[model samples]
Target: MPIVMDVDALMEFLRREFPQVSEDFVIEEVTEELTTVRLAVGERHLRPGGTVSGPTMFALADVGIYLAILARLGPVALAVTTNCSIDFLRKPASGRDLVSKTRILKLGRVLVVGDVLIYSEGDDRPVARASLTYSIPPRA
Candidate 1:
């Protein structure tokens, strides 16, 4: 399906609806095939070893897919993650921002399935991979 919301619209919706995490994510690119998002990694995202934390990577994946869904479905704020399975493949580069590339695997009426690959900015290898399922609320 064609995208209903572009990057600017998605960013604005995020800022207005989810202010707490709005500043942390950058909606880099949105297309019919994929959505790219960046996490501005900071001190708080690091772990004891100075590497990016698992929870932080998971957040990137979750938010990335959420934005992807919104791009196609338009600000569907009620859409929520119903399931997520993630695998940490490698330790993320320390002090580097992380980027997630998300694509919809299946876009059904009630459920949307997506895949996300997370990498430290400028890196070729993915540090983590996630598959997520989101439940889209029925229209009123």
Candidate 2:
């Protein structure tokens, strides 16, 4: 599918519909097959061990794929994640921005599937991998 929204437009869409979290994520790259997003790691995002937490990374992948879906389908406000499976491969580096690079695997009328690899910024190894399934709302 061709892209219906770019990085700036996706950011704008998030800000307009989901203002509470729009600031937590940065839309870095958007395209037909891939969408990249970054989370600015703050002290609150760290675990007791001073490493980025799993939930934080999960949120990154969730939001990144949401943008990937929106980029293809426009602003479908009711689209929701039907399922997600994630693996934490390694400890994420501390106090660095986390980046989620998401690739869409399937886009159907009601379901979307995508794979996400999350890295601690500047690291070559992925800290986690996720496969997500989203349910798209039907149009009226």
- lDDT of all predictions: 0.96, 0.92
Q: What is the TM-score of each candidate against the true structure?
A: 0.98, 0.97
Give the residue spans of candidate 2 off by over 4 A. Answer: none
Looking at model 1, the pairs that clash are none
Superposed by TM-score, candidate 2 places the C-alpha of residue 1 at a distance from the truth, in angstroms, of 0.1
Q: Encode model 2's per-residue lDDT on 31-75: one tens digit a residue.
A: 777899999999888889899888888899999999999999999
Best candidate, TM-score: 1
- State candidate 2's TM-score: 0.97
In model 2, state the lDDT of residue 7: 90
Looking at candidate 1, the ten consecutive residues that score lowest on lDDT are 90-99
